[model samples]
Target: MRFMFKTDYEDDIKLFPHSGYLWSYGSLLLVLMIAPFVLSSYLMSQLVFVCIYATVGVGLMILTGFTGQASLGHAAFLAIGAYTTAYLQQFGVPFIVYFLAAGVLTGIIGAMVGFPALRLQGIYLVIATISFAFIVEEILARWESVTHGNEGMRVKTIQILGTAVPRDSPAFYYLCLGVLILTIIGSLNLLRSPTGRAFVAIRDSETAARSMGINVSLYKVKSFAISAAIAGFAGCLFAHKLSFISPEMFTLQLSIEFIIVIIIGGAFSLHGAVLGAIFVVMVDPFLTFLKDDIPGVIGGLAATLGAGAQKASHIQDSVAAFASANGLKGAIYGIIIILFVLFEPLGLYGRWLKIKLFFQLFPLYKRATFKRQKIYVKSERNR
Candidate 1:
């Protein structure tokens, strides 16, 4: 393992951190830059989705991860953004202008949501956000004149400057990839700023943060707006990807999926957002493989064990039916969340850190270094 000894405080704050970082990130960037050509069309489309979801994850990460706020209504902000873009595009607006409008409009609404959040925390905040989402959904459904009710509104082709970018085109993928990169960069900078520190301070202890002269309420509101704006920007892309906008698309399930993205990815780290996005998107194919292969494998085992061919065939049919059912996907997603929460709470990023440290400290690595510290709450009388 190689180490970079820092010479000064400035060295610690450098964007690259060390030469190693520059090389690693530079190589990753090179890979992404050529991915459209090197990867298949379906894979490129999934990468675009990963980029979009990662941006949304970063937005949610800002609130839940950094600011310590609970939100179950981000899907509302996403809907606002998509509808804003869709509605504006109808008037022949430029992509740059409408994109900004989606973010700005969603930001303003997010601030409104934040106002109510100041008086709430924990589960209450979660419930409030859920209510907010429901309210937004009901309004979208009832406002038939504008939202087209349940019939859904079609999103036009993305036009940057005068060039039309179809969802399937490489240009569209680049557009999303570029947006994700900008979101990550901006988030990193924000976390390094005083305002970002104030967010963390509020998250740790609002009373102590207030005593330290930080405007707790203002920063919480700011965090909400920032997170919402990012989600809104992601929604703009989500709209084009579907080429259709409907209230049903941005449901509570979508909001929960966003939360899952950050959680299973590593809720506390910026890198977790991307990792989680990749996991959430890629897991579908993995599940699809399992759906196809599990039954055959089990049946083959039964046949080898001297079971009749009819019995093996029956077992295979039953397993295949169970695996291929529509509800099975949601069940599997739930199971994954439970497993991750119980066994690997620190998430994919946390797992990667352990692997990295194992190599970095080969022959000296201890499992206890990453073990969760068990704490028991003591009664006041015992204390």
Candidate 2:
């Protein structure tokens, strides 16, 4: 159990609420700084992926979680960033210039999309975003001169201060970590500002927020711009990491994966983005391993069950065919989304909060402490 005693108004809104947070976060920073020295190269690469995805997840959380405006087309922003960066690099643009340009361009585009989308709500907004994603994907595929169409385009190595940073080097990993830290700090600061409060107010009740004199439309568009900018920044890092990108890489499925990150991590919390990114990136390798090994496992199990050689061979072939199907991964993702929505809507962060509360309360903790209430509303009855 940790206790924080507030001394003044400043304490109430401090980024780190307690000494415990300072020490914990400081330790985490230390660990991240030294991680590359101890972790394998492959693991370090995955960490880069986590940081990039976490950036996108945090952006999406700002829109859907804080602003109550959901976007299913963030992958389009990411694609814009990657393609823009790649194109500019070919023209001998500096890394920083193109990176910032990519983000700015995406922000402008996002604002344009959000402006027209202000009248949309609920499922209509979702459908519109989905349509936007498809449109972007088609443009990327057909714009052969700029994007190279389906042939894809290679990204230049990240260069900083006259040094080309190798993708697998510790310097690249540290670069990613540095950018991630800056993003987190920016997000935390933004959330502490009055604008953040307005966003939350809008989220809770748009009519109430408008009545309170908040410019709901402007704020919604601002939220989209900021979110898209962050995603574009992440996409810049992503292109450099992969060294190549295609229209297929930024599909609707990629956007859905970003949504899953926040949904499973805890939509309402910034830390949830990092936790979700780690979970998704870490689990991905295991899924790949399973895809490679499941057929062998099935064959061995069939042999143990005293099946004939031909039968065992047929079973292994069938299992391999199933394992290799691309849709299998999609099915797994869908099932996971369904399970999390049904059983843990608040997600892993919410679960962690519960565990911490239980420990704090100890013997005073009751099973009903956070039980869900089955409230029957008169409005529902009337409907």
Candidate 3:
């Protein structure tokens, strides 16, 4: 029986040549490197934008995603990082040191913010965090000397480790990519360790976890601090990348966008965060192209809007306005959360697992059968 089972497993392994782990890592690396070379300037900008979002998404994954703490004011943390970097840079601090300082400072702030978690849970915690974010923004706006108010602060080319690097240079891309890779690795390692598992256990049930000897409060506060630190690191990277910082950029809307990313990508899973970033980043351009190029080819069908066609030519513009104005991303994100809550709470990663399982177990697999149920159960229990 052992020999038969071994032979069957070998056959299965041969059928699936690439391990999921290898495929995920290799694919991500290849895309990150090749994207700069293959993509146009317009696209490179979008890709850079995606990396920025991914950086924050990773942070959120650690907090709301992994530790089950919800924050709608995450952009506030990013604001803290961005402004801290800008202010420090103005005083002629070394860029790397300033960025590190931003992370540490924000980590401290995050811990303080996590104090509310002692009493609040569920949506109440969300409200507390969101309120904290707004309060911070108000301080930044009113404290003109520091945040520079609505005019914001400008950063020159960052001098890191004794080398000056321009924001838009290819070197910047490499730098952001390196930071992203390291952060992801750090997060993954943390998730696999005892402390990380303790966070997950606490997220699942603070009462139960505490009963089992886990320090629930410690983990909760630590998770917030760690998450905020990551957000701050990403914010500093954004400051350098854009070289222009503004209070307007870190509004509640931006916080909603961060949430959208994890919701669309998959909360509690690193891959989901990455994928969510990609989806949000790419969707605009994809639709823009459709609005412009598609209308040229397919606009003949909607010829009645001929005179008005030029004004409404780009579906992307109108859709984007609607999305931004009515919080389309937020609405979509909420719907996604609802759907996940109703049927597929694991998000895109869960859906991808289902697809992979179907393919791997094909031929013998029946239609509409849930092959990835165990993964969902485990992941949800961890959350």
Number of the top candidate by TM-score?
1
Cα lDDT tens digits for candidate 1, 72-172: 99999999999999899889999888999999999999999999889999899999999999999998899998888888899999987688999999999
Ranked candidates (TM-score, high to low): 1, 2, 3
Model 3 lDDT on a 0 to 1 scale: 0.80
Candidate 1 residue pairs that clash: none
Q: What TM-score does prediction 1 earn?
A: 0.94
Candidate 2: give the clashing pairs. none
Candidate 2 Cα outliers beyond 4 Å, as residue runs? 305-313, 367-383
Q: List the candidates ranked by lDDT, beginning with the highest.
A: 1, 2, 3
Model 1: lDDT equals 0.91
Worst 10 residues of 2 by lDDT: 374-383
Lowest lDDT sum, 10 consecutive residues, model 3, at 1-10
Q: How do all models score by TM-score?
A: 0.94, 0.93, 0.82
How high a TM-score does candidate 2 get? Answer: 0.93
Pick out the ten consecutive residues of candidate 1 with the lowest summed lDDT: 374-383
